[model samples]
Target: MTVALAISGLQKTYANGFRALKGIDLEVRQGDFFALLGPNGAGKSTVIRILCSLTAKTAGSVRIFGADIDRNFPLAKSFIGVAPQEFNASLFETPMQVVLNQAGYYGIRRPVAAARAEEDFARLGLWDKRNEQCRTLSGGMKRRLMIARALVHRPRILILDEPTAGLDVELRRLMWRFMTDINRRGTTLILTTHYLEEAESLCRSIAIIHRGELVVNTATRELLGRVDLETLVLELAAPLDQLPPSRFRLRRVDATTLEVDVRRETLLNAVFAELEQSAIRVIGMRNKTSRLESLFMGLVQGNEDSTRAAAAALSAAAGD
Candidate 1:
């Protein structure tokens, strides 16, 4: 498959000498839902701003659908649509007008834009509120309106920056379904969200950045598999006064439940053997897979540890 968005050696430095992005490189395949995860001030937003032409980059290049963002700004921008972190619609304008106005900015004709806006609003469950001023809509409704605005132009790539933030669970799930439908229809999506589970479920690939540097970029499954540990949840028949001395280390999650992190070589039978010897009957057991949260924390914290280790090594060498 062809690359939908390609970024190479992307760097962005602010006037205050803060390096927001340090030569980040990423390739998003067409028709793929790509999630970019990071803590606040991690440069995820900087990348999105640069891709959508909202902010200028200090160095490097961005290409959307083979058209350079800087050189072929119009053509490249035409292929991209962005829904920013903050809602920027005119509060006084109706939902239909908000979308239609956005479509017009992309050079769509008024009549066609109006028709498309109506269709998108209805599909997203905002048709009934089309004539209501955006300020009159609830938070969830506003979020749906923003999504409709972004889709009015029907760009090939959609960049969503925390699209479901502040939304209720039901609304968030609805938005997820909407995004999946859009992706299934061959629209490439780039999502930046705090919800790790959402990223794990919606994105095929993930890229994590921290403190202005790219940390990890790989297939979501590949990244999760890097942990090399399985979480075993074992429910004991009764509360344990104390844990047994087993080959595998166990963590007491609750009175009756214990969480054991076991290596791949350690079989489930071995765990059962230990429990059986302790006279603890296992009522139920389940394995929890390594999630994005664990993988992300491990990478970022691991980098910190490595940096401290390097500093200590230098100190020791100097003492010699």
Candidate 2:
């Protein structure tokens, strides 16, 4: 497969001496829905900004469609579309006009821009509101408008930063379906969202970044399989002040429930055997598969643990 986006040794540092992005390398394959996961301030946005030319990278190289961003800015940028986290459309502009103007920025002719804008608005369920001022639209409508504007130019790569942030369940699902259709028709997508489940479902691969560094990048299935723990919540009919001594570890969540993190290999029978041995009645039981949320928390918190240790060492040295 062709490489749609590539970054090598990417680094970004602000004038305040805060390093926002450490040396990082990533590749987004053509026609793939690639999700980037990280906590706030994890440099996910930094990478997206650099790729979209919204911000300059302090160091490193980026190529879009094999065209170097720094060397061939126009060619590199032309193949990419960005729906930023912030809304930037003119409040007075109608939805149709907003998208049409975006197309014009890419040098698309007026007639073609108008036609494409109408088509996109209809497809995105914004056709009825085409002539309404952007400010008059609801939050979800505005978000859909942003997506329609991005699609105006028909870029090969779409970078959506928290695209479904405040959308309702139904609207969010609609957008997901639209995005999947776009991907199937050959658009490469790079998504950064707090909705980990959305990424887990939509992305073929994922890259997790933390504190300016790339921690893990692999296929979604592979990443999930690598994190071998699954959570089981057992609700007992009666309250238990303490847990029975058993081989399986358990954490009390409430008066009647206990949460257990069990390894996938031994989870099923071990849990049942332990419950049987203790004569604990399982009134209700729920199992949750390890997902991107757990995986991300593990990586981000794991990094924080190391950083805390290093800080403690530095503090001790200063005391001496």
Candidate 3:
């Protein structure tokens, strides 16, 4: 597969002597829905800025679809459309004007830009709001407008930084659907977001940076599988004063709720059988956290030593 984006030995240091990125290396394949994730101040945004040419790298190479940023910056940048974390559209301009001007930046003709703008606006549910001043639009509307602007130029790769931030659940799902369709239509997507579930559901592959260091990069499913433990939250049918004994690690969340840690080797039926023997009836059950979210918490909480090894092992196994 062709690499849609590539970074090698990437380093960045602020003027104040703060290292923002440390020898980072990553790649996203063409047509891939890839997630670049990290906690705040973990260099996720730094990496994106470097790719979008908004920030200069201290040392290292970045390539967009084989075009080196240093050797052919315009070509590299031409292939990228970025919806930044912050709303950057001219608040004084109408949505149509904002999108059209973005297209103009890419040298798209006015007629072509207008057609694309209309299409993108309709798809993002902003067609009616296109004539409204951006400053008058709601936060979610502005977010969608940014996405519409990003699409107007028809770039090969789209980099979304917290695209769904501040969006309600319904709007977020709508945006997810739109983004998923974009990827399905062959647009490579690189997403950075605080919402782990967004990445877990949408990304085919993921890379995590922690404190300026690349810690985990692997297929999302493979990453989740590495989690040896899962917490099952069970709501009991009846409240109990005392806990029931079981071989599985269990903790009481409340008189009517229980949290049990189940290992990969353990089966749900076995857990149910044990609970039955203890006369604990579970009225409802769900995972305490998404598998990917659980793994993310562990990795970002200074437990990345083992995970870095796992990422290396996966990379080697894939012959990367």
Candidate 4:
């Protein structure tokens, strides 16, 4: 597989001596939709900033498509597009102008930049608002504007830090469709979001950082495979006073609802067979919790000290 981005022994220590990242090593394959997840102050932003050159690394090396970022700055940077968490675009500028301005920064001529701007604006559902001042747009619209601006350059790698933070459910799903389309077209995407469901749905692979350390890195499915048990809530056809006597671990959530812990090693069919033999008719069933969420919590827990330290390091760096 072609490696789009690679980092080795990456470390970042702030002026106050707080370490934000401790020897991080990661690789993102070309054309992969990857998620870089972590709790607040878990060095997610620090890693992004360092990659985009907004913040310099204290040590270690970074390579984009095999080119060292520090040594081949311009060449490496040209392959990257970063949409930071904050809305950094000029609020006074129109959506049309915002994208066109970003295109200019990439040295695209007016005619070419105008075409890309039109395409991106239309694609992002900002075509009608193209002429309107960004300040007049809603919070969600502003986020879309940043995405359009980032894509205007058509970079190979896109890094989005919380791209849909304040968006409503409808807008969030709309963005998800857009993200899927772009990734399918071969743009490598690195996404960081607090919304685990979004990451679970969009990314094929994930790397979670906790306490400024790389805690979990694997394919989404593989990491989920590490989940040992799933609680299935079954809806019964008739209200049962007691759960069916079965070898499976089971409990009654309510009169009609039964909770069964399905172990990874046990066949779900076996659980059903036990219920069937006991004469409990199951009308429907559903997961009691999200698999990805269960794994994420398990991996990131017990790192409160690192969390607080990472937070302080970020604050100190910002103040500096």
lDDT per residue as tens, model 3, 188-272: 9989876677777889998877788876688888776765567899999999888877788889989999999887788999999
lDDT of 4 by residue, 1-320 (tens): 99999999999998899999999999999999999987677898899899889888999999998889989988888888888877888889899898888888789898988898888888888899999998999888888888888888899998888877778888888888888899999999999976677777789988878767886677877656655567889999999997666788899989999998886798988888888888888999998864456545544575455545543433343342
Better of 1 and 4 by lDDT: 4
Candidate 2 lDDT, tens digit per residue, 1-320?
79999999999998898999989999999999999887777888888889888888999999999999999999998999988877889999999889878887899998998998888888889989999988899988888888888888899999998888888899989989989988999999999875677888989988877788876677887666655657889999888888888777788888899888887587577777887788777788887546345545555566666544533432343342
Superposition-based RMSD of candidate 1 using all C-alpha atoms, in angstroms = 5.5
Model 4: ten consecutive residues of lowest lDDT = 311-320
Q: Where in model 3 is the C-alpha error above 4 Å?
A: 238-245, 250-257, 290-295, 298-320
Error of 4 at 297 (Å): 3.4
Model 3 has an lDDT value of 0.85
TM-score of each: 0.86, 0.85, 0.87, 0.87
How close to the true structure is residue 81 of candidate 1, measured as C-alpha lDDT?
Answer: 87
Clashing pairs in 4: none
Ordered by lDDT, highest first, the candidates read 3, 4, 2, 1
Candidate closer to the true structure by TM-score (higher is better), 2 or 4: 4
| lDDT of all predictions | 0.82, 0.83, 0.85, 0.83
Instruction: Order the numbered candidates by TM-score, best leading.
Output: 3, 4, 1, 2
